[model samples]
Target: MRKSSIYSVLFGTVIFTTITAALVSVSSNVAIAQILPISDRNKSENSISQVNVLFVNPSIGNDTKANGSESAPLKTITQALRVAKANTEIRLAKGTYSAEMGEEFPLIIKQGVSIQGDPGSQGKDIIIQGGGEYLSRYYGSKNIAIVGTGNAKLAGLTITNPTPRGYGLWIESDRPVVENNTFTGSTQDGVAVMGNAAPQIRNNNFYGNGANGITISGTSQAQIEQNTFQNTGFGINIAQNASPQIIANKISGNRTGIVVQASSSPVLRNNSIFSNKEDGLVVIAKAIPDLGNSSSPGGNQFSSNGRYDINAASATQQVSAYGNNLASNRIAGKVDLTATAAPVKPLSLLTRRTPTLLNSRLQRETVTPQPTVPNTDSQELNYVQIQPGTIEFTAPGAASQSSSLPALQPASTGNSALLPVPPDQIPASKTGSPYMLPPGLSQNPATIQPTPQTPPQITATTTQTGSRYRVIVEAVTPKQQELVKFIVSDAFQTNRAGKQVMQAGIFSDRNKAKNLVRQFKNNGLKAEVIME
Candidate 1:
């Protein structure tokens, strides 16, 4: 058995282990993932998220006051993430998000939340930088920019980690979607998949990272399809029981194209592995990649390298390359180049995976001076919510109502009152009364008249700070709504004796939250808010 000690990479603790020391055992390498315990894999979260969308505009956001609306956008990704719920879409604008911008590093992407930018242009102007201390499961206290988990989606952004041996994206969740982004300037690897993450990585550009553009290890079953890997130490490195499906990727112009080691088993098909400064493909340390077999033909193409096109000379190995296009003289090891093998079945190509920028199940928005909320839900539950500001949605035609929920005031002693709304939902007004005004306004909705409903109370689980409030916003089935009885929050309180809710907006300066609640009560949608 391999001997190993505790090391950290911001997953758990902070004993910094160098790259050279990680090489002592393959399990200690930066590419090795902290294997999660059984309890972590089966963690349970039952509450459906109330937030449909969150907009982040670093140029003009309010980490303290903004409600994560397109008009009243949040100031930082960290704040948006803090309040984000499952299935929430965190939309980012074209700007640099760095430590200078108050963004914490290793932005842990929660389950069902999507962090997106301009995917059409391949995130040309979207740049996220800097590193923060993360407690690794094994490697303690490593710097990472982003950590993705819980079926999250990362798309249309440019991510970079410049710290020595830092990773750009560390994936440790199951079945997340990573697409249409650029990974550049990371010191170690651009994107590393560890644990049992079965991520779909596609349509991305991996350029100019210090080590491999992408690293797959720790039993991750990733689907790497249609990505461009260039200008790296090694374009793709597979190690330690990682059996990824490498299909239709362009791997070229690197120190070495692909390196498989330490018992990795990746299946390659239709890959253009060619033209590297060193060997095109190096298989060592008992790694036996499935190029192809006699029954099935591998459509992989290999070409010119400074050394041999395929190098497996040092280790004892016999790999099959049935019908894969390569020159026999350029190979240095025992490779089966039986090109004329009969096919058992037709080759199944890997298809590209794309996530709906805006799913119909979520809120839809249209472009204008302000965001236009959709009318997707039935009249009973038809409430306006935040929509994508920068990205357009293909969801059916939506209306122009923006949801501005007024929250309850928090009480001390970690306990407060609840203002519960009735079951199902209350139909919304066609006019979308009290639509949130554009940012920088002295008084939003310039036209909302005040009412006399007492503001709802928020119960506290912790001490409240920096203008935090929890407003009941949506209406769910009574069975689900019963959770409010047992659950109390600093920003959220449950006290409404099982009734319907109202939407609200500004009333005056003395009590904006209450005033907004009163005004929104006119629209019939209860709201909630929390301050961290």
Candidate 2:
């Protein structure tokens, strides 16, 4: 509850509105910016708690006869929304609430009425798919899942709207708290803040949407922080007079990260923009983004994007980029690099208990090392590059995001234990990815050289299916490619680090895959099976 000149909320944390003071932040740097320091970074409880609680379970509860209680909960979220009043809390159970499940589209959440799902899982198990037409005053009829009309909150829900020109959540007017949610597979943006709305959007996972992760327009000023936007078209799209504060979000793996156009001005600070196929931050038209200045350091990090990290599309527009970390030499447009931003160390390099000061949360700038293999002289090479150990960012309030390398523990047999990478690290095969690596990093396993056809021989799949698994056999030598012909589906997958690998088949029975594992083991090859 510490007070300061600047009001602030940490990434992925449960945010309750204080809305005391907010104004232009881009004109200055993060160092001089007055951001409220939260004495408790992980504190979820705050003043202005919900007045009433209503429960809805799509599995067992009855929609028509139920009283929206815990035991006798409503069946569908639409039913709960019909009876929920202002200041009421609607709790959803773990299940799909879609058209097939009887959920009505474009569920309108009234002011002060909060809708919450499982924040811990980022609502992965709590799916709310399908969208309905929402008539917006700014735009015409639009298809969206939920519309937050002023001071309502949508948290801990996995929302998707697959219709053409659809969005997961749309906010119009007033302020809303949209946190700890997963917005994916939408035909349009995961969330759109329009019509002078200033919503607090933090700790959400936005991916695989047709358009940008979050599109801000019509003078909307949103506090977008601590969100990880990957594999989307554009991470954050700002257009036409909208001015939002974009802070501390990791925007990567998209065609482009942040695009500001049509006279919109956004304050960008402490964000990690890296390894995108194109520019990280594209500023077009008359839009002016406060990247950084001499007086206040931006503290933003950029690296390894295929094109320029920050592309000021207009040659006439000299982006006032001062005191910000610039890792790449590729530059487009006129940018004022008057001052050098301090080099931020990776999170793995620091050791601390909890961050009380706002500056301590400064993100790591991406650094890409040369992609080369280990020579024969080197006895062992830990293929994983320098990745920060366990750093947590919130979409589920406490999820750590970093590329994990294979551990080279001293084994008696001198074989490295190949572990499966995090599911999110791997880019989905649905899109065209040049190489969605973590700052251009890939390491070779111990004693195992990579083949030309399949970069690394030691392969592991992250997906898990019940009662069956995919056996990963190491093809250390090129001649070993034909050792197993059990490749079932052309489920060709690229590893999280953008390394292409030959994946084994997913047998219907675990026993069949076990036989393959045993067969590979008998052939003096190290093999392991993981889920799916």
Candidate 3:
């Protein structure tokens, strides 16, 4: 590694029995602040590799005549970026600096320049504020606060409150390191990755942003790890052929946790997704998110969402041969495979922990069978196995008893067992499958005899069934009408006179309706299904 101006010293001491003579030795600590040349701005006429340090202190800096040294620093980061050369280090002090103060918006850093904040403080003191409520270069709203082209690094700074259309950081560059930063209140997104920019975004906190916390688009690839996305619209939005490694993130309290759309294939591993208003993960239109791979363990926990934990919208888009490994994910709602076939059981519920970076050569982890699907009453399933041409249920004793029951009519060619037969529809004679019945269904087979006629089959391909009614979960007054817009964003709604009412969902399938009510109730909403 290349060594910079920063220095450190390590010491070791040992005590022996010779110290028994009431020996009380003293310990001393020492620190030295080294000063270096501000920059080699004039060195274009010559070569001065030794002068690589540039300092910026908003309070003490002089934009007109400062030499960019520890004693004579530049006034603004924009000044340093303009004068500094490649491999130059710009050291920032504690203060709030804005682009409106003679500095430019969308401050572009030169190639190979690393912008670093105070070493003693972890960015708590450095603040970079920018203008614009919405970001659009054409409209002059200044869409991005910081823009980097190549070999740029930013650390230990809080970038907040750019124009609503602006983002904290916008990278069109390649190989940037953005760490130890907090991004908040951006109207569009916290970070927008465009082009082939592959940045390392780690240990960052993104909160209360107007749009998706981070958006990766246009063939951009990034490693997003150990970040916190709270109270945002979407945690991470991957689109337009962008593929990112999203790992170890705590994504909570957002409208939707992660949305994979438009042919983006992102690797989502070891993320904790919970408390979103909508689904934890929504895969739409050919977007394939790799939850698990042979080389790495994929166990993301998803729970407490308003709808299904994972909604694989189209079956034709296959993420993997066995689908993404959801083995250890703590899912509250069932997986809604409306158009897709469910993944196989064996690969879905493997129990191995993810391998550490140092132990890449360890043998493939053992696959642990998922806990059998519990009784379908109040207990939600831990796993749903969707296999090609068959749907397998891991109910404790349901497998042996399935042979005696009437075979469920499989759906279309690729979708078998996609739709489960309701317990109430089963004939009075033959006992129903354990996986089909909710809590109070008949379990004793001796009481009823099998009907001579074949029972009606429920195919998965059918979109609607049973009743076409929705429960009005809540009624809002005229004064609280604004809240209806927020609730309607997640739930269906209708207006009557001056009042607004929220509908859990309009469902022809009773089971789906019940699941919706349960999902709404889980989010502390009073919801029930009404049969019409």
Candidate 4:
């Protein structure tokens, strides 16, 4: 062994180690570039616990130090929210959690985290009540927004009682899925999505809300399907440059069944729009929707609307109306554009005849009072003499041949049969028999005649049946037109029997038709009929 040999070996080892380190460094740089750390992960991981916090029932009064567990649970949703770390899931139990009015439990989900409700568990129910008044004060301040530059998810819970400006559920995280929840009584929109977020919202029920049932805005892309909106002001509203896919929903009884506005390009398909107060589907100012062709065999069928079944304001917007059975709508004329342009004709003569009969029957029942007569009469006489108001006269002195007559003039001042005639008053042939007048004047004597009043003039207007009782079903969204037609058909069959005529068709002026529907409803019939 020589000193030179030992030194050479050590040098070779050092060189080899340097080359290996360089190679490792290059590999690490490439990996860093390809997989950047999620924004929240940039923090020190050692500072947080690996275990997720589970809050069954969080109360402000309970010990905040207690770990999230069945026996030792966090007090309030706010407390659990505070302790939740990135990628941690906070499972809540089912129970009513009360919050003070205007006091919001703000949550900033860092990255890849979820706040979920325990299935079938009590005490995890999250109720955001009066505290949401602050939400109203700060418009556009989202109740919950996942902005951690990562994906998130919320599921299986009930969100309700938000203030006028507060949103029930809001998401800004990328590729989040919000499903299997109930949103009720929201003062504003039931659910809102904003930013560049793309999410899936499905299988939810929104009812009795002040504003839109679901809203997608701010350049967000969402898949909203299999949801229901009942008694809401608007079923689904898309605005603010958002592009969403709405499919297979049941929307009814809203002011506008479905509204597409603010330059949104939503894919609406296979939705049921019926019985809404206004248009079944509405594409308002600046909305540019691309409705695909009908997939049904016969294209699309549009029929049986209480009002116009389809309406579109923008002529540039393309709507395909095929594969529908149009029938039983309450419109004056045809439902398509070709028929609307022709000269309007007067109502059919047979239809016009109906109102005359109706008016005549009503008039006869109101006019012509029954006749009445006096029960007694008074007369002046030397001796007190009574003259019956009603006298019974015999044809030949037989009871069966007698008839009663009302005394128009008082009986002669005295009983002429009992009075003695003076010699001067007696006629020449009255000596042996009763006095008689000349044959011509004796048989029939005329009494004083009264002038006749002109018969009351009876003027009746020529009756005609106008468009008063007709209805027009309308669909605001092209996606709902087919379903609208089917529902209208069903309604027509149910409503039209004897007097009510049902006819279904399309219309350009859906708003005017909706106004008429309200009028029809006021006349004891269901109006505002929409088919989606």
- Number of clashing pairs per prediction, in order: 47, 5, 12, 57
Best by lDDT: 2
Tens digits of per-residue lDDT for model 4, 66-94: 55544456656565556666656766665
lDDT of each structure? 0.56, 0.57, 0.52, 0.41
Estimate TM-scores for all models: 0.55, 0.56, 0.54, 0.47
Predicted structure 3: lDDT: 0.52
- Ranking the candidates on lDDT from highest down gives 2, 1, 3, 4
The parts of candidate 3 lying over 4 Å away from their true place are 1-50, 118-122, 131-142, 293-295, 314-316, 319-532
Clashing pairs in 2: 6-34, 29-296, 383-443, 463-531, 464-531
- Could you give the candidate ranking by TM-score, starting with the highest? 2, 1, 3, 4
Quick one: best TM-score, which candidate?
2
Query: What is the per-residue lDDT of model 2 for residues 191-297, given as tens digits with 9 covering 90 to 100?
Result: 98877888889899887664568878766777888899876556787765566778789988875688766456676778999977557887755666767655446
Off by over 4 Å in 1: 1-50, 339-532
Give candidate 2 regions above 4 Å deviation. 1-51, 339-532
lDDT (10s digit) by residue, model 1, range 359-425? 1211122211211223222111011111111000000012222221111111221101111211111
The residue-by-residue lDDT of candidate 3 on 1-532, one tens digit each, is 2233222211111234445423432111011122224574454223222237878899888777766767677789888888787878888888877864556777787789999985334366787777433343312233577876687888888776435244677775588888888776554467877567788898887765545688776566787888988765567877555667787898887656887665566766678888765567766445656665444445677778656567553222554312232332433222322223322223311222233521253244343332221122221111121111111111112221111110111111110111122222211112232223211112221111211111123221122344465545653543222222222222335663454666533545566456434433432355666677
Of the candidates numbered 2 and 3, which has the greater lDDT value? 2
| True-structure Cα RMSD, model 3 | 21.4
RMSD in Å for model 4: 34.4
